[model samples]
Target: MASKKNININLKVWRQKNAKAAGSMESYKLDNVSTDSSFLEMMDQLNEQLVAEKKEPIAFDHDCREGICGMCSMYINGRAHGPDTGITTCQLHMRMFNDGDTIFVEPWRSKAFPVIKDLVVDRSAFDRIQQAGGFVSVNTSGNTIDANTIPVPKADADKAFEAAACIGCGACVATCKNGSAMLFVGAKVSQYALLPQGKVEATERVLNMVRQMDEEGFGNCTNTGACEIECPKGISLENIARMNREYLKASLIK
Candidate 1:
């Protein structure tokens, strides 16, 4: 087999001092990028070069570069989490691009996810939405029963497990024309609504979460399906429909 080739590429990265600071795209040429190197690794190389030149390095959020954290978010080549699908930015490989490719990297653009510095954005809005109601209350003082004793249908349990896989990466919002977050919220709601333990809090959970989502300044889902297409976890659009049903049921309950 032939050896992998290293490529040279250009990058147009967005730089910002802070949320209140004005920002613009700054260009840089990166050389000898190994095809085997992960996108974040190439970013590390760029930072090393910047440091050697006595300039401030780019700042991007990343943890668990293996892709589970879903923290390494970037709008690359006008796509959420880069030019790839079903993976976060950290999981993107340099091999996907050619030697002369000019990659455009920017932070997740949403009113809720304001840019913090360089490629980093403030995604705490998701945390606040989850905090409003992403859990169930269970008795613990000698009254709690073992969850294993409960019988959950395999179909519902599997869907719930799949819905639970959401990592809150904000890719859906970045890829959305309206900067909507219904996909994420819907996944969170579906994970709970599918389980018997979660049924008790279903009405309150959907109401609180949807309410907090709107309060975060995220736009409404217009059903363009962009969120489902760009979601790194492959979260389905059905969750959004399920969320809509849950929300409707909750509204009537109040």
Candidate 2:
């Protein structure tokens, strides 16, 4: 095996003391960063350097760095999750940049997701949307039938699983020029709508979720398709179409 080379790079990081404070990009130079290091690990190194100098370290969100938590939200060099495709910020590697490259890191930007601090945005809007109607209300007090007993078409099941892959990372919203959350909401809606267990309250679920999405102040989807392209999970645009259909059916039936 060959030894991976290390590189030096410059970082431009956004810093804000609080939600009410104005923010600006701050520059820092790093030396001998390993190309094998993950982006979050590089960030840790930066923080360590700052602390050694008695300066307040950059604050960024990260947990379950394996990419499942979606807490590591970052806009790197003008792209969500750095220059990688189908990966989150924690999964981005330092090898993507060269020695002399300058990397810019910022938080997810949108009216719905206000900045809580440097590189940390409040994504609770998604939680509120989910709470609105993201589940199937089934009575579990009695004897439950085996999940396999109910027959489901293989196509619908597969699509539902794909939609369920969304991690709620907010990259779709950040990447979209309009900062629309249609892709995220669509995935949440489709995951339920495609399942037989979800059919009972399907109409109400769609209506409530869509209504909550609008109330959160997210921009409307203009169909530019940036959300689908930048999604870390590669959640298909088809889910958006499915959500639209579900919403229309719900609206008419109600």
Candidate 3:
């Protein structure tokens, strides 16, 4: 094993007192940052410096720094979840930048994702969308049948699992020029639509979810494919196509 080298860098961080307050990019310098440190760890160091100086620390959202929580939302250097691809902010490393590089960190931007503070946005719209139609009504009583008894095609099963991998991070929406959430909504819809247990309410589920997504004021997908490209989970655009089909079928049947 080799010792990782350390370097100094400049940070351009967003600071906002609250949702109603004005925000701006504030510059700070960091010294001897190790390349091995995760991006969030570097942020912790920055906060430590601010607190030591009696200045209010930057506020950001993060939980389960392992990247599963999807709560660590940051737009860094004009890209969602930093400049990395297929990874969340927590997964980004200091090594990605050069010693003299200046990094800009901002919150996810969208009409649906209002900034709650510096580097933090209200993502509860996703929760509302899920509440609209993200589940299967299962009887948990003793009369419930075994899941294995109903065999599903391997292809559908794999695809459903892939769609289920979405962590509900708003990167797809942030990266989309139109601020569209089609990828996120599509993944959620596809996860259940491909499964037999989800077939019962498949029609209603897609319709309600899409309707709720629109009501939240997320922009429409224009098929530029930025959402799929920047998705941390690599959730496929195929899910979007599947969602469109489901929505069409539901519209016709209704």
Q: What is the lDDT of candidate 2?
A: 0.92
Q: Compare the candidates by lDDT and give the number of the best one.
A: 3
For 111-178, candidate 2 gives per-residue lDDT tens digits of 99999999999999999999999997766988878778989999999999999999999999999998
Error of 2 at 127 (Å): 0.4
Pairs that collide, model 3 = none
lDDT of 1 by residue, 174-242 (tens): 999999999999999999999999999999999999999999999988999988878888999999999
Please identify model 1 stretches exceeding 4 Å from their true place. 1-4
- Cα RMSD for candidates in order: 1.7, 1.9, 1.9
| Segments in model 2 whose C-alpha atoms lie over 4 Å from true places | 1-4
TM per candidate comes to 0.97, 0.97, 0.97
Pairs of colliding residues, candidate 1: none
- What ordering of candidates by lDDT runs from best to worst? 3, 1, 2
